[model samples]
Target: MAKTFASVGDLAEKTISFTELGPGLHAFTAEGDPNTGVIVGDDAVMIVDAQATPVMAQKVIERVRSVTDKPIKYVVLSHYHAVRVLGASAYGASEIIASEKCRAMIHERGQEDWESEYGRFPRLFEAADSIPGLTWPTMTFERRMTVYLGSRRVDLMHLGRAHTAGDIVAWVPDAGVMFSGDIVEYRSACYCGDAHFGDWPATLDAIAALRPKALSPGRGDALIGEAKVAEAIALTRDFLTSTYAPVAAVAARGGSLKEAWEACRAACDPKFADYAIYEHCLPFNVARAYDEALGIDTPRIWTAARDREMWAALQG
Candidate 1:
């Protein structure tokens, strides 16, 4: 029998966690599902990376109500991915924010990405019809910006590009915590469909420079201590290098995408086979790496048809 494509086979729901890293700072994690970061301030709350749909995002809202009755004031987008941003409506916040480039990417490829991702795994978009089209940032920044949920200062910066060209991290200086979107995943696979393999490490370095005491990574459980935080960063870098190295080597020798896929599996499966969405991410990761190795600077847009074509050709 043939294997299921992307996350179509992943139907089993994961256990969710709402962990506090500091006073009023919480991370909403669902096993290895997409994680949401919460910052409850003196007057209101700010949500980092809205869930995939209004229905799905309601879960996060419920958790926020458990801790505070304050209204959600801002929605900070870490990057432009359908799984992360499509749930903005549920927040009912005054401002929806993201980097300017992220907003452009949404205009450029958001529809196709939405179609591509929704097709990949309908489970994430729990109530697809509930999504009010693509989520847009009512506010945008170029490199750095800050939001004050009252006296609390939350710094949002586009440290460097890793997961996506416009990826940003939300930093809370007083609490020493950062909500690193997919740029830093925990035990989950880094979905590299739009990743920049060559530039990922420096982005990781920029993140390490902040010396965060804790992090709510894109997926997996929250990292609570500096040591655990360091481990997560290190492991994320390892996962990226281990994946890119073998695939790049194959492409350097003029190998085919299929060859690159096989090479990447051999090198990474041993170490990352158990990771959440590992199987789903491998094909996209290899394709992007192969393109980057051949001097492709920008990642090609992924559409639903293109996704099917790539998966069928790679047989991944």
Candidate 2:
């Protein structure tokens, strides 16, 4: 039988958890779904990676309200993915911030991504119509930008490309907590549909240099303490290398995409088979790795039509 496209069959809702990593740093994780980070500063709050839709964001808002009544002053986009940014309206944040590359991607492929993602994971797009168009960043920075809410210093830095060309992480220096958005996923498959396979390992090295005490990853449970943080980073690195290495080798040899996919599945399934979204992400991940290995630097834009075509060719 042919495989389902993306996460179409993933209908069950995940349990939500608001875990405190530091004094004022929190991680809003929903099982294996996309995670959001909350940093409560003295005067205000900053939200990392908004949910998929306004309705879904409301849950985060409710959780935010539970602990700190401080206004949500900023909503940060870790990258330009529809599931991560379309919920900006619900926060009513004074500023929506993103990396300059992310803003450019929003302008380039935001609409197509919205259509493609919504079609793939219907459960994540609850009340999809509630999203007020594509989320745009009010402020964009190049390498690094720092925002201070009183004495708390939150650094938004683009630590090389991994998940996307625009991927950034929210680093709280004083608290030693890093909100690694899609750049480092723990117990979850790295979605490499629009990823930079060649640059990803070096990026992970940069993250390791930080030596964060606690790390809130893009998905899965929050990593608290130095050991867990290191473990998660290593696991993420292994997933990326394991998935891309075999696929890239096959592609470099002028193998067919189907052959590359089979090679990737064999290489990655032994360890990552039980990880979240492993099955859903494998096809797209292998396809992108194959392209990258064949010398495509920039990721091709994925539309609904392209998604179907790729899935059919790979799984049919």
Candidate 3:
């Protein structure tokens, strides 16, 4: 390995913000770090995505305590990523819910993902020793599931494959709000290391059809208006398209991976150079785009060693 990940030396902590989206829905955002959604109900609360570790998750618990005294009885996982799902133990939620595919992925490559992400995100997993093991869902669903928190109804649905093959979004019909897990991002670069680029656009359309009045994205700030929601969704689409188009063109012409990386940078740097995680996410995104363009239907698993090898090959 000739080069290290950009996140390795990022020791500075971000200022966390707890934003209220609606009556009881809130979002916990930290600059470009992963965000968590909060859903308070008549009976208890439901956490959308757990942070990277139990100690890291304590920040979210403190924020939740400030708002409601209701116990968090449900832990909902949006995807199987280690940085998102590994903090379930801190919540002590009775029922941890996720999609069937999400659980399958956890069983398949969750450990490798844990190692891969821990090296990539040194700051996010500072308390890596506190994590017990991989997180598994207590409750798994196929297409959609409806859970009633007393009078409020929250619908968890697998809209489509965007960020990962098994990503779910939580919709609160009464509040007209959606907690879109990495499926949507606002002013932040979407991580595509384990993504489905070909199927991501259609998934964005599905999110658009929801017509959410407010949304809690996976990163950046909380969207609190219809126009802002639309803008975020559109920008997310643009980010995806801008990233894949040039790489696809390069791949079709039998170009090298370095050539594809340069093409992606030339196309994306003008518009998204300043976005959060742009440098950290670009190499992985370019690699995935190059693979998808070459008819690789599934994204290859990323291990700690593979991350170093790929980084050296592309970025060195």
Candidate 4:
């Protein structure tokens, strides 16, 4: 039988936690599962990264209810991912926000990605049927957009592509906090199937420039203080670098995928072997790194079929 995680089992429907990172800004994390950030301003609230389904999003809604009753006026999608955007409709926000490139990705491969993701991780999509359809953003920005929640300013900036082609971060300057989407995961898989490995480092540099006092990453626990925040950032960067370097080296030498997989395992399994979903992520990560090292700019599409084929080929 396939192994299941306790966190995944707990998140069967949805789980919620309310951590007050800033005065009115709450992190609605889901039992160590994918997290959602809630920012309450003077006039309205903004939800960062909707859960996988409307039913799933309701869990966040219930948590948000515990803290503030302000109407959710904006649903901001950090990027174009089914698990992140599919729950957007439940927000009933006046506007849905995303980067213009995010919209284009949804237009191009939303359906494929939806199918691919649901298949790869069935546990994360417990209420998959409740998803109305591909979530589309009503408002799209090019580089950045600033919205005011009363007097507080929320800056949404596209800090170059790492996790996806249109990845963005939510920066609350006054609070010195950043919601980094999947651009910075803690003790979890980087999900590089749709990532740009070559550009990810520079993207991390942009995030580090903010010197956030706290950060809510895509997975694991939230980074509380400045030192822990930097620790999380550095750990995520190390995870990516350690995993990629060996794969890139083997690829550069014209080694086969199997050889490259062994190389990556030798390099990363020693350090990040205990991390969550390391096995599940390594094949995809190596495949992308292999492509990039060979000068492939765009990542190859991942389907349910491709996932198994790559895993089998690389594992054996």
- The number of clashing residue pairs in model 2 is 0
Which portions of model 4 miss their true places by more than 4 Å? Answer: 1-16
TM-score list, all predictions: 0.98, 0.99, 0.98, 0.94
Q: What is the C-alpha lDDT of each candidate?
A: 0.93, 0.94, 0.92, 0.84
For model 4, how does the per-residue alpha-carbon lDDT over 184-234 read when each residue is reduced to its tens digit?
887876778788888898999999989998888887677788898888888
Worst 10 residues of 2 by lDDT: 1-10
- Tell me model 3's lDDT, rounded to 2 decimals: 0.92
**Model 2 Cα lDDT, one tens digit per residue, 35-95:** 9999999999999999999999999999999999999999999999999999989999999
| lDDT by residue (tens digit), candidate 1, 220-263 | 99999999999999999999999999999999999999999999
lDDT of 3 by residue, 89-170 (tens): 9998999999999999999899999999989888999678999999989999999999988899999999889899999999
lDDT of 2 at 148: 99
TM-score of 2: 0.99
lDDT score of residue 209 within candidate 3: 94
Give residue 64's error in model 1 in angstroms. Answer: 0.1
